[model samples]
Target: MIEIHAKTSAANTGSASDRLHTLGLALPDLRGNPYYVHHRTVDSSIYISGQLPYQDGRLLGQGIVGRDVELETARELARHAALNALAAAVQAVGELDRVRIVQMLVFVASTPDFGEQSNVANAASDLLIEVLGENGRHARTAIGVAGLPLNSPVEIQMVCTAV
Candidate 1:
């Protein structure tokens, strides 16, 4: 179960973190250690490494977003990637409430005919907004790609301000 932080009211009417928990989503464990770090911070800004739709170290969806993977599935994977990004941000800053999402770059693996990158990205955007309220709003770019690492359907990376 995901833990709802106390500072989520300004992001939504209810708690965004609580919404996430009710959706049955859980943040992935950050694989950072002394040797390798998943996120880095400079001043109050935290840069989260690219996150895939992974849980328990396994990539969730495989194949191209508009081909082998359906749009809905890709969207769901995007949500997972968003969760992973949030996990990284929270891990780096020590609290979810301290995170103010600044930007998100979403990449979707797609076929030549696919053109719904924005719709797919909305899955992540909506989730972030629901979880963090105003702090979750951020500039975003959605790009369709030929492929992605680990054959995953989507990948996401983010920048956040830790207050």
Candidate 2:
């Protein structure tokens, strides 16, 4: 069984955005431009649009995880989707340090026989924790679905408190 690491109470080393850069990950372009936006703010909260594991107009991997896709590959896709979500949050609030993750909703495309949804979802959860430390700890929901947009293996959405 894959082990899910507990959240760490590490010192605030740097902004979440900087941590992402240190990890050698880049956020994709926002879905909308100057007019429409991929994220929106209401009061002190920011709502990020669901993001797929797509980069440079290409889906990272497709098909059901544990069947057509390997568990590791699907986990990577989840991380990618999380990066997109972080990018949207940054774009909305101008910096990752200004936002505190409140909730995360992860949707996974899986074969009927696949039952390790939490393990797949951990990729995103772990990334956020690694980047934001304590602030990364948030309510999460991992759901297995029959399919996803573009048949991508994972999609992620987030809600944050913009400070």
The per-model lDDT (C-alpha) reads: 0.85, 0.83
Q: Write the per-residue lDDT of candidate 1 for residues 45-91, one digit (tens) a residue.
A: 89988899988977887999777999999999999999999999988
TM-score top scorer: 2
Query: Model 2 over residues 17-63: C-alpha lDDT tens digits?
Result: 67778778777776565755678899888998888887876778889
TM-score of each: 0.87, 0.88
Which 10 successive residues of model 2 have the least lDDT summed?
A: 1-10
Candidate 1 lDDT (Cα, whole model)?
0.85
Question: Which regions of candidate 2 are displaced past 4 Å?
Answer: 1-11, 33-36
Clashing pairs in 2: none
